[model samples]
Each structure stands twice: as structure tokens, then as C-alpha cells.
Target: MTNAEANSGKKAVIFNVQRYSTEDGPGVRTTVFFKGCPLSCLWCSNPESQQAKPQMMYFSKTCVQCYACVKACPNGANKIKDDGSVWVDRSVCTNCGVCVKVCLADARSMSGKKMTVDEVFDIIQKDSLYYINSGGGVTLGGGECTTEPEFVGELLDRCYDRAIHTCIDTCGYTPWSVLEKILPKVELVLFDIKHMDTEKHKELTGVGNELILENAVKIKQMGTRMIIRLPLIPGYNDDENNIKVMGWFMESWGMDRIDILPYHRLGENKYDALGMNYSLGDLPNLAKDSISRAVKILGSYGLEVHVM
Candidate 1:
């Protein structure tokens, strides 16, 4: 939706509106989660936010097998064929969001919502006092805010006009032009650094880190406040060499603050709900000691580190 429309109460695609979140960004903040992401991080916590389009999600465990979705589907998307099993005909389904409303067990749900900018602003403004008190304001998180550059820029610009402290939690996978357009409007950026190894980066997130790394340097040069977030995945980029390389890179780039996010199984259920397999199922969370070790390694380079 256009900014005018968004401001005028026209709908824009958003997945979730999280409040009182501490980990996303500074403060007792409200996080506006936009739908759609460019990169597919295997350890993505919000699998529901990946797709740009609205889609139906199923919680098999919560389902009573009452065939409510089957009966409620207008396009016969939920049905049993000759195989004697229910199937969701994704192609025919318009995601009209009907079956989700009728589901009694909360097994059927829709991921994205179309909200206006004015609507979103109202939500964010509600916690303005809390933000002022807690050093937190509004945080824009998503599949990738840069993927919807126009919308993101306008949102930030509006927030800037209101003197709201805005932070963008991004994967840095967008074009430089897009980043350039939105970066000026934001106060702080929570840039995610997934992997240091280019090949391993591609293997995990479907793209290399070249552009991401490059953009980070450019962003640093532009003097935007930034904090680097590293997701420590076991058997992946958790090696000492990898951590050292990442530490060196951050040091060279003059990034002082780093947040090491330990991998967790919290999102495992989301993958299943989205009808996707969890790739990191067998992988265990990095031990607290390991996180401490990584912190020490980065600290040795004189970097301020926070392990979450």
C-alpha cells in the first residue's frame, strides 16, 4: 500500500504486533513485524513471517480432526480426496481467511494481516510513555523491512516526525538503493550477521554474505547507530576460527557492540505449523559455556558483547 493510503487507513501487510519485548531492540517497545523476507535463515524464529503472501497454517497437535476447516473452506481447499485424507489445495485457496475464523481448536490460523499505517501508528503510540521511560520506542522487524522499502521508509519517516526512537532489525539482504533510502530515517539498526564463511552463509541462508557485509561497512561509514547480532548455531559458525574471523571483521569495521543469540528450539514448532521441516532439529543449543567462550573471544578484541 502507498504511504498516503497507509496513513489514510489503507491496509498494509503485517504479521504480528508484539509489545513489551526486551530482546528485539532498546526499551519496553512495540515491535511491528512485517511479512516477507528475502533470506531464508534455517534458524528463523518466525517461520510464519517468511512468506509475503498470507497463508494458512495448521497446528496438527491442536487439531481435533473435526473437519471444520474442510467444511468452512469456500473454495474446497480443505478436503479429503480419494486417498481418504484431508489436503489443503493451496492453488485454489485465495487465503480469504475464512477457515481460520471457524477453527474451534485454534489449529487453523492465518499468518499475515493487512493493516494501515495509521492503524500501526496507533498501536505504537500506545506504548510511547513506556518507551520514553525504558529507553525503548518502536522497532520494525520482519522477513525484511528493506524488501518493502517504500513502506518501511515512510513508516520510519513518520516515526521520525514524531521524534520516536526507531530501530530496524534487519538481515541486510536488500539492495543498497533500498537500504540507502530507509537508513537515513532510522536511528539504530540491529544488523544480523549469520555466518562469516561465504560458502557456509549461502548453504544456511540461500545467499552469500558479500552484499550484507558490504552494506554493513557502508552503513557504519554513514554513521548510523548499529549493533551486530550473531546467531551461534552449533556445528556451523560456532567454531573458534569462525568466531575469530567474525570478531576480526567487526573489529576492522569499528563495530563496538555485538549480541550473540544462542540458537534455540523455540521455533521448531513454527516450522511444523508452516508445513516445513526443521533442518536444525538434531542440532543442540550452544552451551552457556560456549557462549561465554565466544564472548571472551570477542572481548579479547575489545568488543562489548551481550550473550542472549
Candidate 2:
């Protein structure tokens, strides 16, 4: 089959298409958040990203008490409790997204939708001028973007044709074959290192780090530029050992730049909105000195670290 026939027509459930994002990669970027991730991290900020299917997200604060959803929901899933709190009756709500359309206050929304390569590319290319001026381009992120390899690869292929810089913010948990197909079109790989020890990694992220580490090596072998991203969860992986080990791993790979993504409670409310239990809900906000401390430790190890 031709490249067009091979990768086209496949649809992936994407949760968000953030425009003018400076954090996903260098310069300006359009971050595509694909839904569905194989690994479940204890402190995942994007709980809505975990599921591949379309899901509902309710913002109770945004509700104007219009009760439009109450009239539109075919399943009677929208209701006002005795205390006057309007919310989706998630128990009976099928997440068909029917009520989201009728939500007058923009309080109700769906997190995922099926999109072909062309649809997503349309959004990406609209920012082409920004990409050209800022050395920025597209970054395919997740839930776990690689879960839909064919679709993502095709998107990258299209970006390549347009001369757009392409990258992926990946957990590195998927198979090498999955990444192998897409890496060719990827200019940078933002590889995340949740924890160094395999058992500890599994304990924190619901998956071992073997595949992730191996994928790092494979990507390096392919000569793809990479920026190692480490989320510094204060009480979790901020220990000296984990930091040193991560630094050493980078040192081993002859890598220099590592981005430390500080932990935050931003996604905590998102969990409640999605009717999911956030395991780290009780964890305090990351200490003010956490990132600085990590930078000191990694810098001492001769690894360049920057806080994102």
C-alpha cells in the first residue's frame, strides 16, 4: 500500500488540541493529546487522558444552574442534588456526550473524540506561521500518543511534508515496533522518566521502566534528538537515589539536557470532574525549593537540568 493508504483513514481518540503551547517542545507548539495510556501513574495530572473512549468532564463551578442538561439528557443523567449542586449522575450517564452539546454554560464537555489525520493536521498547520518564526512545530502527547501508532505516524508524516518540526512527549512504555514506525518522522522525543528502579517505577506508575529505558536507547540509536523529562513528585521520586540514578542514566547515554516538570495539583480537580479517584489527592503541593534542589543535585552530577 502507498504511504497515504497505509497510514491514512485510521482514527485516534484525542482528548485535546492545545494551540500555542510553549511547554510541549521548543518554540511554539500544537500539542495533540491522544486518549488512552497503557501505564497508570499514581499522580497522573490528566486523568481524562487515561481512557481511549470519549468521556465526560463536568465543571461544577461553571454551571449557571440553567439545567439545560437536565432537559437534554435522554438517560436522565443530569440532576440537581438536594444541596443545589448540579452534576452529572455519572452512575447512569453513558458518556454519549449528548448533554455536552446542550450545556449552555460550557460546564459540561467531552474529553475525547475520533479524528482522522486530516482533521488534526488542519489544526496543526494553522499554526504554521508561528512554527516557522519560533522554531516550533507539533508535539504529539498523550494519555500515550503511541497507543495509536499508525495514526500518529501518519500525522507526523504530514507534518514532515509541510516541513514542520515534529516531536512526541512519550512515557516510553510502548513497544519498540510501535515507536520504530513513527520515529523516522519525529525530530525530537521528549522521553519521561518517572522513576529509575524497575519495582519502584511499577509501584508509582503501574508499569516497569524497562521498556521505557530500552526505548530511550533505541531512539538514541536512531539519532533522534531527545530531551529527558522528569516529573519531580516531591515525596515520591525526589529522593537522592532516584535523582542520582536518573542523572547517571542520562550520563550513560551522553545526554545533557533534562527537563524537570514540577508536580502540581492542577489536574486534581480534573479527576473529580471525570469521576475518577486521584491517588495523590492528599499529597501536598510540591515544595517551593523542590525544583531548585533537584537542579542542584543533577547539576552537581554534570547533567544540565531545567525546570519546565
Candidate 3:
């Protein structure tokens, strides 16, 4: 298809465009967080990213009980309670963004926006100098980058056409056909391996690990540069046995590098904002020893290990 045709009628709902992120890829890079995900991971940090469409976010701390949203909402979704605190009836809220646009305290906010390929590229091109100098480029990530294959494919194609390095941060829950479409344009793959066991993986992520596991091998076969990432949720996938099995799987697949991402309560507040329960409630950050031990286990298999 022609570039113009590819750009036409193609748009994705993106929740964030994080610039100068050091951890997403190499050097200074922009991480485009696509909205919507198939898997509902127990410890999702960006809870707002779960939906495919735009959503509302309320910061109660900044609300002054002025009932501005109450008056602005067409659905009467916003309400002022007895204690003079503002309460948002998310059930009735349509996320019209009317309340968000009028709120001056930066409390009421919308999470995602629709953007065409060219529109998104306009923002990406702003950092062309940094990307060129620092060997950094664009990275498409969660809720799952592969969720919108065409949009992501076109975006990555554009980046590659500009001689910019590209990456995809994926949960590996999507079909291999989707990954096949994305891998050719992606220079690096930051693939998340949530769990090794099927039932346990299903329990934590609402999906079995079969497809994810299958795709990991396919990714390796495709000869894509991939770094396996483990979320390291304590009392879940962080057990020594799971780590050993993961290490064995990587070794069996000749996957040499792994990054251990320790779990944190960072998403707890986001759950509150979205009015959702945090599955890993009150779970402390993965202890340093756990991190070190995980590294040692993977390293023992002659694999390069990192605590990212």
C-alpha cells in the first residue's frame, strides 16, 4: 500500500506519549503507550490503559468541592457529596472530556486520545535530534502494542523509513500472526513473560501462558532481538522454582538475556483512580535478595541478567 493510503483512516487510541524515557529502550526514547490490553495483569501500573477508548481520571486531592464538574457533566455523572467532596459517578460518566476541559485545578483528566499516524509522527519528529544523537527512537508499549497491529505497523514503518531505531514492549499475549506483522519493523522486543505455569498464569493475568510461551519461541525463530522481561510479583511468579523454570526455558530456546522487573505498589493509586481493586494489594516491593537471587538463577544458565 502507498504511504498516503496507509496513513488514511488509520488511528489508534493512545493514553500517553512519554518522552526521554531511559528505561524503555536504549538512550533517550519516546514510549507511545497504546490504550487497551487483552490481559488484565494483576499488577498493571497504568490501569487507565486497560480500555480501548478514552476514559476519565479524577484526582480527588486537587478537587476543591466547587461542583464545577457536577454542573458541566451532561449526564450528571459528577456529584458533590455531604462532606463537600466531589464524587464522580463513573458508571454514568461518558468521558465527554467536557468536565476535564473546564477543570482548572488539573484534577479532572482524560486518559486517551485518538491520533492518526501523521499526527503522532509530528510529535515523534520533534525529538529527531535527540534520537539521532543518542541512538534513541520510538517504542510502542502497553496496554499492549500489538493490540492495534495496523496502526503500530504503520508507525514503526514510518520510524524505520526515517532511519530511526524502533522497539515494541509487549506482554506476549497476542497471536504470533500479530507479532509477525510487528517484528519486521521492530529493532528490539521487550517481551514480558508473566509466568511459566498455565493455570497460575491464568489466575494472575486472566489468560493462560500457552500462547505467550509459544510466541516467545516464534520470536526467537524470527531472529528478532528480544530481551525477556519478568514482572517479579512476590508470592506469585517470584518463587525460586518459577525462576529456575523460566531460566531453563530461556536456555532451551537459546534466549540469552533476561531482565527482572521487581513489582511495586505504584499502580495502587491508579486502581483507586479507576475505582478498581488492586489484586496485589499491600504487596511490598520485591526484596533485594529476591532480585539478586533471580539474577543469579538466570546468570547461572550463562545468561546475561539485569534488574530493570
lDDT of each: 0.85, 0.89, 0.87
Per-candidate count of clashing residue pairs (backbone under 3 Å): 1, 0, 0
For candidate 1, give the lDDT of residue 273.
72
Q: After superposition, how far is residue 307 of candidate 3 from its true place, in Å?
A: 0.6
- Model 1 ranges with Cα > 4 A deviation: 1-11, 79-94
Candidate number with greatest lDDT: 2
Better of 2 and 3 by TM-score: 3
TM-scores for every candidate against the unseen true structure: 0.92, 0.93, 0.96
Superior by TM-score: candidate 1 or candidate 3: 3
For model 1, the local distance difference test gives 0.85
What C-alpha lDDT does candidate 3 achieve relative to the native structure? 0.87
User: What is the C-alpha lDDT profile of model 2 across 30-126, one tens digit per residue?
Assistant: 9999999988888898989998999989988888888878888899988899987787778999998888898878988889999998899899999
Which candidate tops TM-score?
Answer: 3
Model 1 lDDT tens row, 1-308: 43433453445589988989898888788899989988888888888888888878877778777787898888987877685546676678888889889888898788998877777887888888898899998899987767777667667767777778999999988788888888888899999999988999999999999999999999999999999999998878888998999899999989999999998888789887777779888887687778888999999888999987
Per-residue lDDT for 1-308 in model 3, tens only? 54633675698999889888889988899899999999998888888888899988888888877777788899998877788888778888888899998888888778899988888877888898999899899999979978999898888878877888899999999987778878988899999999999999999989999999999999999999999999898888888999999999999999999988889777677777666778778687788888888999889988999888
Clashes of 3: 0
Error of 1 at 303 (Å): 0.5
